[model samples]
Target: MNTKQLIEEAVSLPLEERAIVVDSLLRSLNQPESEIDKQWANEAKRRLSELRSGHIEAIPGNDVFSKVWDRFEK
Candidate 1:
């Protein structure tokens, strides 16, 4: 049917059902990820390279948490 008819039918749906329809429509659209995704991937690669080259010290999680708690308690 026409856009107006389709919209009226959609609006008549239950709230949860309408939400599902909207979600499906959004997912069907072709969209690119945000710039932050690209930046995150690049930063992850850089960190991996640094780890491979031994450019940074790897601290244990327990030690890190201990230090955090020490400072937090003071």
Candidate 2:
């Protein structure tokens, strides 16, 4: 089917199905690189290990956001 016809059919789908279709289309246009994803996963694991081991202290989200807002207001 043509683009217009395809769009009409997609629009007729149920909300959940439409979301799946949209996500599929977006993923197709922006494919993730497995190597970069793996690197990010490793970094996340390292950070979590550090936090658990007390090698680094976790900052409270409220304090972080307050500092950010304070900087912006200056």
Candidate 3:
């Protein structure tokens, strides 16, 4: 549908449904990737490289969470 008709239909939705529709519509718009995503992608590449080169360390999940909680609860 054309923009005006589409907007009219969106406005005619019930209040809550209209809000959901608007939020979904806005979120469907293109967004640029964040810098953290780029950094994570690079780090993943480095890790894969290290794994291929047989250089790796295994850390338990409990240890990771303990460290995270220590800093988080501080």
Q: For candidate 1, what is the lDDT?
A: 0.92
Runs of candidate 3 exceeding 4 Å displacement:
30-74
Which stretches of candidate 2 lie above 4 Å from their native place? 1-29
Candidate 2 per-residue lDDT, tens place, 1-74, comes to: 99999999999999999999999999999999999999999999999999999999999999999999999999
C-alpha lDDT of residue 16 in model 2: 100
* Full-model lDDT for every candidate: 0.92, 1.00, 0.88
* TM-scores, one per candidate: 0.52, 0.62, 0.38
Count backbone overlaps in model 3. 0
Candidate 2 — number of clashing residue pairs?
A: 0
| Best candidate (score: TM-score) | 2
- Candidate 1: regions farther than 4 A off: 1-33
Candidate 1, residues 12-32: lDDT per residue as tens digits?
Answer: 999999999999898679565
Error of 3 at 46 (Å): 30
- Candidate 3 C-alpha lDDT tens digits along 1-74: 99999989989989999999978877689564789789999999999998788898767999999999999998
Candidate rank order under lDDT: 2, 1, 3
C-alpha displacement of 34 in model 1, angstroms?
2.1
Cand. 3 Cα-lDDT: 0.88
Cα error, candidate 3, residue 62 (Å): 39
lDDT of 3 at 49: 92
